[model samples]
Target: MLTGQTLTTPQVVDVANEHEVGAFIGHHTLAEFHGVEPALLDDGPQLRDMLTGALAQSGATVCDIILKQFEPQGVTVLALLSESHASIHTYPERGSLFMDVFTCGTVAKPWLAVDLLAQAMGAADVRTNTVLRGDTHPCCQ
Candidate 1:
């Protein structure tokens, strides 16, 4: 598992309040998974289940989801959540997986879902970037 710098709760609150009067849009985490098990990447059902479980663990309300498998190898899974959405794409040949989790509202933690997906995929290394999305102007309120 890869560890990266995380924003403290106060920092998050401060960012959220930076644009006074406007509601926080959401949090989005993009992850690059390296050295993941090939078998795990090719298993569409397993990947789907992992994403679903991760979303549930993150307190996201899953609205819809879809999984697609390519010929020979590779799988793609997408979950639509009440907060936002999460998706996973696997490249078994490259021993890599790419994932994104975006969640709206203060109650959901998209980073948790990213971590869970990395763990479930048996990643040896993970690189992640998180962005706070939404209107930043105070007038947007």
Candidate 2:
């Protein structure tokens, strides 16, 4: 259960199975944003800011961030989160970008981060995939 105060913090939960005893601690979200403004994808600073804001809004703690701009066009922003990590790689020519957010607990919402980023990038088309990690399930792993 999450209260307002605890919503921003990672909470450990027991996700043990009959065969194994451990915690299911990973939530990974991968997204592709299409039909965005090319300029937005080329701006490293703006992309970093967008990712930082999205992580914050999704209740993930940012440890550090690094942004790199490419020669012709494009940008990449990587955020190190207390929960796990998140990254964005842009393709300015295609007006698209790929985003990934993975958190190591149940509290932080990785999907929300993807949603926020997509909206901020003004993506006209968005596709997302979520994988629950730290489990023995073949599909999840």
Score every model by TM-score. 0.82, 0.80
Identify the candidate with maximal TM-score. 1
Query: Taking the tens digit of each residue's C-alpha lDDT, what string does model 2 give over 1-141?
Result: 221111122233345442232455677888788889999899898889889999999889999999999999999899999888999999999998888999875667898888778777778888777776776357665
Question: How far is 23's C-alpha from truth in model 2 (Å)?
Answer: 3.8
- Write candidate 1's Cα lDDT for 24-134 as tens digits: 677888888888889889999988988899889988889999999998999999998978889999999999988998877666788888877777666778888777766
Error of 2 at 97 (Å): 0.5
